[model samples]
Target: MTALYPLFADLDGRPVLIVGGGAVAERKTRALLHCGAAVRVGAPRLTRTLRAWAAEGRLAHLAEPYHEGWLESAWLVIAATDDRALNARVKAAADARRILANVVDDPALSSFQVPAIVDRAPLTIAISSGGAAPVLARRLRERLEALFDPALGALARLAGDHRAAIRTACPDHGARRRFYDWLHDGPVLAQLRAGEPAAAERTLRARLDGAGEESPPAHRLDWIDPCPADPGQLTLHQLRLLNEADVLVHDAGVGEAVLSLARRDADRHLLDAGERKDPGTLRDKILARCAGRGNTVALISQPA
Candidate 1:
């Protein structure tokens, strides 16, 4: 069940205890420190950096091996000692206390497995294979590191800063999604990658400004009307219409393969109808911008 849960950051000052002084313990300690956890390490000795942290009083260290009492007050625990018996003892203690525990290279004793993490600042990607594959995970991370530009972290931060305004402007979930689609498209990302921060900010702000307009055309109300299209010729018309749309509002569909031919970065929406179908007035304004610039707007139905 924990497998599906996201790896949340330790930004809330969670207490983590690492029981070891070796290289594995050192690696885990560094990661926890980077996440801003208040870390306490229990080991008979320490590495150079661990000793420095203790000297600086940045983290607490116990000059001893695993003790049953160390389990108290720890939110998460890591057993990285070479001693198998001690690692097993620590795992049992953690299980009794319901604390998340990770034993280095020991799957059965672990309640949670740490992934090969990629940190691009503000953007963190964790890859885990349920302990079935660690080397594969590292290789995958390496591949992803090449694909995911470091600039994405900065863009993510910018998006975070403007989130409130974005929510207000693009009130509907669908519209808001479309805006993000536009955001990740070549132009905006290119500007950011080129170090044109002002241009990027201006582009995003302009999008927000456009989306917040009071009202728009009735045809713009919903990306796809509730009515389903007839098969055959309608599909062709849908395809052609998709090509003309500056913004394409599409839900999960069997026709996605067809739709992909339209525009590489065209805004696509996946609508789960429980939420607002149309994000809001602001989104319509962005679509209007596309239309004004002679961009086509297409709405494709979800695949059956």
Candidate 2:
């Protein structure tokens, strides 16, 4: 099996041609319409729902058999007809036009495969099996749907609303990341989930203005290894902390990819070999800075 690179396409107002008006085509059309695509369906016959849609002018109905010329204006094409020969012809025509096409139930003839999706408006999760084990992929999507709260969409919207202000207030990359982390896991999210959007917005504005709660006296210091070649190897907690750190004090040996995870505007201090030689001095220095600034400091080092 060929490895497929996963991607999300913006089909808004783009023409999509579906060669068939049967049940499969109807499903495809509904999905396309939900994404604001300009759908044009061609078939000798269509399902009652599809027929109704055509009558209502929701999509263009060819009311005839598929033709090669139909591929001309389409950004993407779908061959969902029951006839194998017709599907093959559709695939060939699409190939000649260098257009991306999917032949229903036939992965070998398809240039792309649609994955099972969990749509949360601005946030969508797509799970694919690379044209293998589709049912398993759907089951995984179901699990994810259950695990993720619907309120995430609201949270995303809230962030988007204040994005400019947040950027201006927290100019440093690290500080911005920390703000986002707090926004995601703090009381503001709880308020939003409780349907108190007004309260959430108020809290968000206050936090941005630095009028929020003071930091606790007991600060946390995370000793992390920055040698992982794959960023995926980092734990979710590690990833969150890296993104949320106010200060990142790292050994000189850390890789760029690991360091990149930290906020770009974060206060960075290099722990040279000589400084690292004195473990006691290094620990006191990190703690003293954290105490003085009341900022969260992350000490990144190789794992024992």
Candidate 3:
């Protein structure tokens, strides 16, 4: 199957319809409500939680089965009914209106797949297996959920709050990158983790105010061992450097799969395979790159 387009919708105040009264429908309704969507459930009967939510005005409950009218004003619809025939009818109605619809557990009828989410608030990560391997997707999400610390969101928000000030202080794009690198690597996040937000803010302010250490040398070469066929095999440290690198100097044997991990705007210099025999060639290339802006990272891999 082709890759699905990934999207995050702002459903605040937007109307959406769910055509089931079961546990699955309840799950979908709660998620939509959390996103501020105006949820309307069109089922003859609802589960206990759904009934309670309807009573509390959390969502509008239609005491009737699925119909074409429900799709008239909906931004999207979830057909979670146990009846496949009924679900198919809902899918057809939604299709006639050009509305996006997802029939639960039926990817063939779904216009969009709801990915397994790793919610870090401002830093949400989503994983999908193209509806081919849902268990695998959930497993990946679990790993990410554990890998990312809860305080990471606080760190992101703090950085967001200082965005304008950071931009103004570090006018040079390269300088701004270094400042952010320092911000992430420095004591600010540690202070936040220690439950000292005030201290964290002070540290951030001090750095922006030039009371912090000077920006590290931005023009240097850091080489990685030969890249494996899969870029995912690289360590986190290596991935971080690749993500932040402004320049990539590599032998042609290094695949695009690995090169794609670096900043899309980074400069790429492909060294001659034969040049590896003589260390002077690479040294000269690094020297030339050092004369310019930003830092360089080379992948000293096997010759093509």
Candidate 4:
């Protein structure tokens, strides 16, 4: 399976088009509106909620058949109608205009794939299988939804509030990482969970004021000998490395199963068929990244 680069688009106040009026289209409209997209629905009729929203001036109602004019000023378009021909036409029009389009249940016609989302407000987790197995992706999202605490959203918000201070306190890459690790593994989350938010803020300030943690090597490169492709087979140390590595450089032999263990925010560099034969070039690129502002941990399948 080929890789699909995951992205989180900020649609605030951006124009977006929806080419249907049924329940599926309604769902899309609600999500788009939540992201502050200026939605325009191009359908002859709308569902109860859709019609109500249109009447309330929450969204514009075209009240006509789908046409190329609907694509005007749209950052992206979604066709959720059951009519296959209509969906195809919408997809073609979007393509001609160079706009991202998604035709419901038709991955072949879509320029973008919507993933199963776990909404934590500030911290959202999305899972997708490149539209090959949406059921599996949704199932995984269910598991994660159960695993993550909703308090995590509040925690993230708190961290966001202090992000600048934290950056200033720990300027070195290694120190910043250790500080974040402390934030995660230490008492900040616990204090919030325990309903002592003031205590949590104080704890964060105490650390930033000067906890004095020794910073490790600024350029430590680690290699994981390729384990079983199964993610479940990874050892504790390997799991830690996968999640912690800021810059991952993997060979073609690494499967997605292993690759998926890395954090979504990680900078991943996957070597293609041609790049595999040229390890030296890949190494130089990794070194250049490491030499930048912060420390970088590059993942390799074997000794370079």
Candidate 5:
């Protein structure tokens, strides 16, 4: 199996070519449209919706069979045709041009695989199986959909609005991280969840100004047990915290799958039986390291 590096592409206003007009192509077109991508279809025939979009001048339609030059000026290409030879040709053309191509249902010929996405505007969560088990990835996406609140987008927008001010107030990276931790864990998130945006903003400002009630300490250790063997099995909250961690202290038995989810720059410390000889002493040592540093530590343990 080929190892793939996962990343999100910014397709806003970028030209994307779709080589089929079937349901699959239509689905891909809708997703592209959501991202504000400029879509161009090269199919001889299009789905009814695709035809409507073209008639409305939303996209360019070739109204002809696939050809070589269609790949020109395209940032990305999707081969969703039922014809194997045509899909192969599209893949080959995209490969020669170094353009990223996704051949629907044919991972072997494609350069990228589109993940099942949970869209919350600026906050999107994508789950992929590296073209190994798409259905499983979809199932995981569905599970996450229920866990993330739709109001998160509103909360994110609020944060974005105050980002400059927050950065100015908290010049230190660690201090900024603590402020965000407070924003997410304090009354601000609750107010937003309750649909009280004004109240949330008021609280956010108060906290930023240090006028609000004392926030929960940001420097603390989170002990996580029954750690997931597969990164895909981790809960959304776990994944978020892992990505936020400044330091990760884990037992030697912890799997790389879990560690890989942490921020790439996070400091890692492996704990052996010697370090575990006194649990309280180890906890104190970790806490001391975090003091005045605004560092958040994640202490992981294997399932007993």
Candidate 6:
């Protein structure tokens, strides 16, 4: 099953060895340095960028080809060398030593696959094709690049900051879920998307204040016809319906762009029926919440 993995922290001062000095190695080196890793480049030759980085003391470049012993103390390794045999050898060594290694264009020889990434400040998205469709993965990433408004990070930060308050105020699972739905569908998402963080926060706070201890529970709208006239268009009607949906249960083949349109505050429930949502338990929860709020709950299914 596909899943969202937890974010890994940067290796600021940790040692990471890059085995090559060609174009591929340069690209890998740049990414490592950007993430604040103390990089060491081992190659018989170096490119202009590599030479400059070494000159600036940003990376340690050894003018000798890679030796297997270099893996002894390194935390992570990247075998970007042109030699396929050497990359495989390095991958095997890294695996034996429990170190993470990525071999360029060689998924079978890699311990970990490096995803095509989108770094939007505080929000970083990593996309992988399981080593099957790299070009397609990158194309999809470019499309996503246009969809995520810059204000998303600011809005995410605001939500993160008041997490404690929201938790304390809305103790009941139902209440909390409702609040997030309101927050996402309300003006907060639009405000942030328009590059107004302070306005978004103010609007959210006001909504929170207006809500009562036993505020009206959220109502789920009926399943929206995924078939809008323009299949590629995001209709306002759809947005309104989604805003009120407390839990969005969706299936695979849902377009990433379409899913991205969901209210940021909505409690997303992936429809993994048998293995995840115990049918009886989910049904009971839905029924109880709907009863409390006098709201009709709806389930949306993607068109097959």
Q: Which candidate number has the best TM-score?
A: 3
How close to the true structure is residue 21 of candidate 3, measured as C-alpha lDDT? 87
lDDT tens readout by residue for model 6, 1-304: 3443435657989999889899989988887888999899999999999999999999998888778888878899999999998988888889899998989859766766677778765678888877788888899999999988766677678888878778777766667777887776678989988877788889887866665656554454355544343335646766666555555555443444655555565455444545223544655555554454433323434443
Misplaced by over 4 Å in model 5 are 211-291, 294-304
Worst 10 residues of 4 by lDDT: 293-302
Error of 3 at 28 (Å): 0.7
With a 3 Å backbone cut-off (N, CA, C), the pairs that clash in candidate 4 are none
**Ranked candidates, highest lDDT first:** 3, 5, 4, 2, 1, 6
Q: All candidates' lDDT scores?
A: 0.74, 0.82, 0.85, 0.82, 0.84, 0.73
Give a tens-digit lDDT track for model 3, residues 134-217.
889989999998898787788898999999999888877788887898888789989988988899999998889992345545
Q: Pick the candidate with the highest lDDT.
A: 3
* Poorest 10 consecutive residues by lDDT, candidate 3: 211-220
lDDT of 4 by residue, 109-198 (tens): 788988898998899998888888888998999999999977788788888999999888887665787788899878998998888889
Q: lDDT tens string, model 5, 1-304? A: 6788899899999999999999999999999998899999989989999999999999999898889899999999999999988898899999999999999969877898888999887888888888889899999999999999887887789999999999887776667777887887788878888999999999988778872334444575666665767778878877777877778878777788789878787888777777666666877876776665445555456532
74-155, model 2: which lDDT tens digit per residue?
A: 9999999999888989999999999999999688789988888988767888999887888899899999999988878888
lDDT score, candidate 3, position 246: 82
- Candidate 3: pairs in clash: none
TM-score of 2: 0.76
Q: What is the alpha-carbon lDDT for the whole of candidate 3?
A: 0.85
Candidate 4, superposed: residue stretches over 4 Å from native: 212-234, 238-304
**Candidate 1 local distance difference test against the native:** 0.74
lDDT of 4 at 103: 93
